[model samples]
Target chain A: MSKLASMLSTIMILFPGVAMATPDIIRQQLPQSVPHYWKWGSLFVNLQVNYFKVFFLVALLAIIIIEFLHFVIIGPKKFRESGKKIRVYNLFVRIVHWTAALSFTLLVPTGLIIVFSKFFGGDGFVRAMRSLHFIGAILFAISVVPLFFMWVLHMLPEEGDIRWFMVGGGYLTKKEVETGAGRFNPGQKIWFWIATVFGTLLFLTGFLMYLRKPNFVIPFVKYQIDALRLAAITHNLIAVIVLIMFLVHLYMSLFAVKGSLKSMITGYKDEEELKYMHSSFYEKIKHKLNE
Target chain B: MYKYSRMKFYCDENRCINCHGCEVACQVGNDLPVDIARRKVITFNEGIEGKEYSLSISCMHCTDAPCAQVCPVQCFYIREDGIVLHDKDKCIGCGYCLYACPFGAPQFPKDGAFGTRGVMDKCTMCAGGPAPTFSEKEKRLYGQNRIAEGKVPLCAAMCSTNALIVGDAEHVSQIIRERRMAHGHGVLDETPYGWDIAYPNE
Candidate 1:
């Protein structure tokens, strides 16, 4: 389509959001060259790259925290008590875990290549890096899709989990803390919700930024750009906050309260530890095991 | 030691015809894309009786540019000759410079289908791209940098009325002051000449 026609349509679509339709006003206020490109086209792509970087950064932190809790915080204590028989992650969880983990790691560096390409110019290596980055971002986005379902079954909060949150989940102080959190604590549930909401926003906003050809419409470009900027800010902020939370979660699971990592790692907790830490669930599972 | 001073752009309002000649001069000389102009004409009509004066606005290349101060990465740098330049590598595309510049100079390319061009492009005073000397990459990203080749900007040189003059700061300032003194307290002194004074409010 002709540039002017496309520009008119694009402006018409975004007209409701901003006062852009009055050509007289636009002519007066805008520089003659201002609309040479679409209203907010460049800003849109920038927001996309930034948002993904934020998402990957947060996911990486979450992985690190979950692993740390297993090895350092809860692992040693579990080993001392049960002598290394518990497994925190099952075989299926491990497969999904790694697929998502690898995808997340690949997304950041790849996405950065495209975002930073202007500085590097169109040099061969830079172009190659950006191409790879987009591929990695797609992989990461695809891998995250299944996590919602996996989490749907595991991350729901019960009344007991709410109580766990009320007492600060016994994370703040070391002694006199009782363990009553179920399959997932209220804290983990909250992170799951964040991952779902912000993660979806990041993916959809990111896809619009690509705006690849025949599939994407021109009029939505401005909207895509504005929404993308907001998504980027939200995505990055969540990533940073989530990273810190994951670190704390890791420490608690592996060593802080003891025997927590053993449950995920070996798929079992000492009978006594289970009785104290997850009495209600333990009783139910134990009764089933006996039957 | 390198000397530090404010960079400025001066326009002789009396000479401008509001023809937008300067705008075309800048775009063609710099090979800017279809819709971008490094220079522009702004017109104000008042006092009836068919009297209106047009002012051209672009990068003032200020001595204390707001773009430089607010940039988070400190990408902007002022040359010893008082020309402002920035490293595209360090730029984060935050658009803070747009808010800070008294005379809006920074220009960003439109992001199209071939992925977004994250780098910012602007008038380099006809000195070409970020790279040294004229090369294909620089030409593609920025227009020619003729000043580096010991040439005056095409826009200033092409001004039919000599309204735009690009040169050492003292010479241009002297020329404007002389024109104002010779013309006396008429439209030339007030219109495009003193337009910068009236610029902040509008």
Candidate 2:
């Protein structure tokens, strides 16, 4: 019985439809003959039909989910947080953040242009769309400069990070005690690292592709093409994760934590909330006042 | 643009002879790098004798161009004449275009001074490039946009069998219609060829 069960499981994985072929067994099983001269013409048409719609839907769904969650569920929650809630993200940071977002949005469409044009068909519209997409990529690189600087001062890891990652830093428990850390949290620091590495990979890969330089030291068009393919997959996967992180950030800033969004907009947080939420820094400042 | 009125390219498989003439003509005319073809001649069923026909595939420039819709910086533009082009300086070497293009047209050089070629090169429909008429930079990077100089693409012009055709939509369609009528109905089984061969290994 065990041997029979094992065989059944193997067949299930290797050929799921094979088990259901009892009815098909009696049906016509003749190999479909190719048209006399039709074989050459069917190659490009078949592949395009297979891949274009699948990838398009995956990308479209990811973007829509991220956007919907940010604007609808998370945006309002941070507006109602207690205590001081002003000035979390400065003007320069805000500018860079939005610019990065806009550039990323452009990258999606342009990327799609190259994919669909080859396998499916490139029309005049696809060509025009790609032009704008490349332009957006340039802007994404430009936006990085300002964003890089705004976070340069705050990215170093702190001792509290180890505890924060492990213990949820009182956020989960609602204990409302400030961990002895300054500036950003360990989670935010990790996000910075992800963005930095992935962004650099995208920039380097993108430029190489644009300049038409396919000669990797290994020397093959297929190699360069493969590398580019890997980069694209990585870029897309990372984008989905980052967008999800941004959704969390949006939730905390706008809806989860009341008055938190105000700090980003107006650049000031309430003193009482600061002391309650960030007691370590508050204590340092309050002590200095007593001195 | 709506679906029906959007511009498209249709390949005639019957006339192609596997000679790769279109591929070579495009490279020579555009000054594209060695081993870099903005357009390629692909054969689906080879070694079958008299059953093989080659298709020269490149960018199709779609109506609902997925690439344009996804660009974050809004860099794409639509010309009144329906030719699509871009600014190289404004391009970041992201491979998004590769994923989005269905025809696999855009190619990165991958062989330059820095061991990295950071710009994309592809067919500009012989419409020249993104510069003023006959500028050296446009000519150097994108080859001569001969269409702007009142010439059709050299590939189509040089087609030995006159298989490939290019021009305004109406003109090209009229030509194809005439060919079909001369050959009789169903004489050429309009099986869009490029898309099938483009992903053959998969």
Candidate 3:
């Protein structure tokens, strides 16, 4: 028996494939060039398991602190309720805007809860939050298409955009300066693109994640990549960018510029706000006011 | 002093015939849904003469389980004997555990609207759950609790070739070592297939 076993072992060693076939076959099947992003020691796992929660928490705190300090020191861009209102947003526009806003309100908190789930403790509450996250995704999906087409023309970069950026859209200082902005200020335009473009990417990646096993092949690649892992990495990265911009949008609408929130609600902007913040836009629209 | 023992499962690749008996046994014994497989048999190098081998895989119940780490609800818990388990009630079915798990051990039933996932399900090693051991609720939620009754897991028990073994880590390793020696193999340079990722410290 010992002699037979030794002979068998010698034969196995000489013909490795006979004894251990899987390793060589696996190597041949998978592309050697592309790194496996889903496994440990990769950037995707490290970010998801270690740093995502910290990054989100720090970003939230920084935005809140900075905005709070700005509010205290420079104060809001106060404008008198000039009794007369300009119809800046139509009813359809207001409806679409609020629908997107509602989605954000749901998505942001629930997404944060998911990221900080360890602290919150898993249960029905967090589970419900996850369900609500999906609901928010649905609402956003409904609103994004209309929201994009309705405002894309207005959101295009104008000659005055450079000047608006240079003067910081008259946001830094108390003194009212000529911002040379359009109907949608350069700041609002930036927020618009971020919300629409990055928001779409978020939805697509999120849909991929929702599928659980998105194993389709890429157009030019010979080897299949772990699509679920790639989606997760991309989703988290885009989420961070979108979160920061959303906070800025929230601050600008609710606090940074007084009466800005009213326009979305009532489909009208105060004449005083229109003149100072959107000076060039006011210059063009004032003729109609005079008429 | 009582010796510390961590329960683990070891699959002898050379011995596995890929008959899928383990998978069928687990499914039938647990009354699992058709879609949810607690254990599976994977055959590598299929149809290749003298180069084909098979492996039976499920949750390894790692010392530091990634599913436990990533679960938003802190639902997963490791028992004193190192059997990884989770509370079904606490699981929200967010699928984070699936992403974190290297073996794709976590399984979700599409029990929600628009195909949204319900709570997670996976191999329990037949140890049941936090529910009262051997009770109807425990059996319904987490299948059989053979471990509690001092019996081997159904899959391992049903393996015809004795390819799948489950027991204390030390005992499992001893069996593996004995098998290697009997086969005239020398000391292996590497650990078992997923041991490096699953039990880094060990």
lDDT of each: 0.55, 0.56, 0.80
TM-score of 1: 0.59
Docking model 3 quality class: incorrect
Task: Write model 2 residue lDDT over A95-195, tens digit each, in one string.
Answer: 78778767766765566555545443443445456566657767878987777777877788866666566656445543455555556666667667666
Error of 3 at A154 (Å): 1.9
Candidate 2 ranges beyond 4 A from true positions: A1-168, A171-234, A239-291, B1-10, B111-114, B186-191, B194-202
The positional error of residue B48 in candidate 3, measured at the CA in angstroms, is: 2.0
Residue-wise lDDT of candidate 2 within B27-47, one digit each (tens)?
887788774677776665566
How close is chain B to the truth by TM-score, in each candidate?
A: 0.80, 0.82, 0.95
Q: What is candidate 2's CAPRI-style docking category based on DockQ?
A: incorrect
Question: Considering DockQ, which of the candidate structures 1 and 2 is the better prediction for this target?
Answer: 1
What's the CA RMSD for each of the models?
8.8, 15.8, 10.4
What's chain A's TM-score in each predicted model? 0.57, 0.56, 0.84
Best by lDDT: 3
TM-score of 3: 0.87
- Model 3 lDDT, full chain set: 0.80
* Chain B alone, TM-score, model 3: 0.95
